[model samples]
Target: MPCPERHVIILGSTGSIGTQTIDIIERLNQRGYAFSVVGLAAGKNVERLAEQIKRYHPYAVCIGKETEGEILRQRFPKVRVFTGEKGLRELARLDEVDLIVNALVGAIGLPPTLDGLSLGRTVALANKESLVVGGELVTKFLSEYGGAILPIDSEHNAIFQCLRAGRLSEVRRVILTASGGPFLRVHKEELDRVRPEEALCHPNWAMGSRVTIDSATMVNKGFEVIEAHFLFHLPYERISIIIHPDSVIHSFVEYHDGSLLAELASPDMRIPIQYALTYPKRVETGLPRLDLEKISRMEFETLDHEHFPAFATVLKAAKQGGTSPAVINAADEVLVERFLEGGIPFTGIASGLQTILSRWESAEANLKEISSDAGNQDEVILSTLLAADRWARKAARYLSF
Candidate 1:
């Protein structure tokens, strides 16, 4: 049987990585490649999405917000657009989408990722929540159905690349490098003094709001650690984070024989996106090539858990296993949003999470307890997460006074 033309569905297309993926898609199309866009999704960037619709017309498009979807429908009557979680799932599981690029940020990206992989599609996952929230379940599903994940996140992408030449049994450890966000040098005592604008201004890579904040707390890297654990099928101890401010060398994998392989490149999202899109066959993505001469001093340091408590929280949760990590992820998402809203102090993110876990307790850990299917446990935990988030916000807001 002849292979179908390479069709891709890009979720969160209006965001940083999504926009770059579209740029790569346009380049691929211009070169008379078989790849075409099947689905596109964004939050509120209907105007640019309309431009995307006019250029490389997608078969399906989704807007997660209703007002945006309504506006988009009124504007582009010819295009088929969807809204909300159901629509996101439709776009994810579409048979036309040979591969799904999940660039959406936060926990919202979790459902579609689960749906995409569950349906046996190759998931190019940029979203960390899928692994952070549903790691065990996703792992079990992938094991059963045989779906492949092409890590679009640079750190995971690096580990994925390094492991290509070596076996897991021979692997000693996976060292995931981080940019250390904009606050690598900021003292822990001063974290509470940071404003939203300062936090948003990332020193290295340009990205969405939530992730930028996550980077500062080191929660983003922590999420990546849990993700690497599931993606590489290694224990939390085997997955480590190193602060590399240069962001040139993405990650490193050390073999049992003391040999460490590293993947180096400029902090370019297109490289990884293109790699997943073309996989095995390297495609030309009109992006600027990385120059080692231009980047002179690439340094690495140990992550300061004393300063960034969120990293320690995720690692501890990962050690607990089962529903604990999921709870940690969900609570953190809520707390971050609250902090962004001036509801909680910056340091309260870890505090809120710690409170939730302390209440959930170690002996109480179970996947079914946190899942939406289990009667009131889901509602209880979710409500508690939101409540804790609200409490954190209150604490943060009061702290301002």
Candidate 2:
């Protein structure tokens, strides 16, 4: 008997994880896996999107830039091309798509994620901000709508794999390992002097500029902690971060019985992406396998909270429920952009986030009034999150650090 086919849509089809997902799809199709892409969504990468369309022959496509969307519509007359975030949501809600590979960055990924989950489609989530901004809402949707969130982040994916070994109650702690980024050895005082290019040069993983920079400051790990809290249903205290410079052990779960289960790979994003897309079944990826004998040793260090203030800031926001996480995520995105564009120094990222959170805290009374009401409808809650996100971006942009 033939396996049932999965109809997929790559939401951020031009980015790193998106392209790698397409690669996995192509390879799996050749390996007797029943997988097909029915749609693709990209942001202003008409050429790359066109190439993807030509290869996969998806029925629908979307682009962020209206002119680029038009160009695609003209080029691929047979395929439907939707424009902007609306278009992205359109792709997500399509009845034919069985899975949504949400590889988009930032808060833009949140809406499409909600839409897909609401429509009972499993969302392969690579975007951390979706959980960071609205973990409560996303989880609620899962319970009500009967869909699953398969994490595509390597560390979270690792933890997911580890969790399978025992019952939820038997798991004591989940430890996420970080690559320590490119500036792991650099002194804290010298972080401000580091150039954007220097910070972007991650020692272990090749990723988008924003994520790479976040990893340098260990902010990405903090985001992962919050994500772990939501995905695994663990407390913030049980979710911990350790600096593992080797990048080999993606993550681990310590069981109540004093045993630790870990997942190790060769720092490849496709490994976890593949696992998320094709759950309960493992396929031959033809990638390099781990050879522990050749490797001498793996090192683990404590997270230097003092050096990476953004790490502490994210922890603080995650500890404070409601709209605080959304605010911090929005501010971090803006600060990362400013740093990348040479408008702010590397150290300015943490300082700016601290200042924004402080301002919001000072006006907590009014901000709480604007934050999501637990009893409200999902759409209303979503609106409140977006409102908070917008306010934080504006506050972070104009604030001096």
Candidate 3:
């Protein structure tokens, strides 16, 4: 039997992933794919959001800020309006949406994700931070709600596709490939001198400013470590990142008997986005098809911990699991934003996280002891964790250049 038309709710629809998703939807619409747009949102790209609405005609749109929402409402008075972060949540929770694609970046993506999953919508997640900060919450949500959390990130999507080749019991390990960003060639000692422009110039992919900086700092890769841990339910030690200059091989899975499986394709977001969209069925995409002949070389190097300390930071946080990864993520996001604003050097991203980790460790907080909230999970979930985040940001700001 054919699946019914799927209704999509897209958050951050004007951002890189969101815009590419809309592009995919346009192609799918032309090809008779059975899907309708229900909701779409972004952070102040009102003009582009309006263009998306004119094309997809979603029932609602969110701009992630009140002023922008007000302006959009005035521009299109007939469309149902949603304003600010809460409005984003309301849009995510809408009943008509069959699937929600979360494209918002950073920790800000968390609440809408929770709202979407709580409403039992199938979620295609491009926002890896959601899993990084709240992996346990995400797992519990899936267990309780039975909503599928499909990955839209290329690496995780590759792992998702590779896992299909065999059973989980046979799986041994997963290797997430990274292009290593713009600084892969920069000497270890030269990192202290890296400027914002150099860090933002990603060699392989075009992304938002924050993620671009995260990629250069490898904090993005660190977040992906936690993401893979939750998405595949693998141990942190078993989940590894390889610095592959060519991102052709997205990710790989190894079986217990030593058989290896890999997912390879051109570095394209539409492929993974479409995979999550029309899951269990592949579709024709206008993306450049992978050409093996021209790409005659594939190389992999171990992630240089000596150069990128963020890699070790993630491993430490993962080992000290519970709210520690969330804290690390919250701090890194804040610090990365500062670095991008020219308040700090590129190396400050890791230094800042390290400072916060030491500060919290010395403070009256024990992440493992506080996991289940022997006394206040709600407070941990909201206040303590938030305070930890704020405290980390303040420390980073003060210590940073």
For model 3 the TM-score comes to 0.93
Worst 10 residues of 2 by lDDT: 367-376
TM-scores for all candidates: the values are 0.88, 0.96, 0.93
Off by over 4 Å in 2: 363-376
Question: Candidate 3 residues 1-401, lDDT tens each?
Answer: 55579899889898999988888887887777877888998887888998888877788888867888888788788778898878888898887788999999876687778777776778999999788877888787788777889999999999999999999888999999989999999998898888888888899898888788888888888888889999899988788789998989999999999998999998889999999998988988677889999997999998888888987887688778766776788788888888878787778888888877777677535543444453545335744554555666666667745
What tens-digit string does per-residue lDDT give for candidate 1 at 1-401?
43348888899888988998887877766766677787898877878888887777787799978888888788778777899977888889887568899998766677788778778889988988878877776787698778888999988888888999899999999999988888888887898888878888888888888888888888888889899999998987798788889988989999999999999877888888887777877766567788878876778888777888888877888887756676677677667787888777788877776776676574353432444453454344443333333443343333331
The residue pairs in collision within model 3 are: none
How would you encode candidate 2's per-residue C-alpha lDDT over 264-360 as one tens digit per residue?
Answer: 9989899999998779788787967889997899999998888888999988999997888899999999999989888999999999988888887
Query: In model 3, where do residues sit more than 4 Å from their true spots?
Result: 1-3, 364-384
RMSD of each: 4.0, 1.8, 2.6
Clashing residue pairs in candidate 1 are 343-393, 344-393, 344-396, 345-396
How do these models rank on TM-score, best leading?
2, 3, 1
lDDT of 3 at 133: 74
Error of 1 at 186 (Å): 1.7
What lDDT would each prediction earn against the true structure? 0.79, 0.89, 0.83
On TM-score, who's better, 2 or 3?
Answer: 2
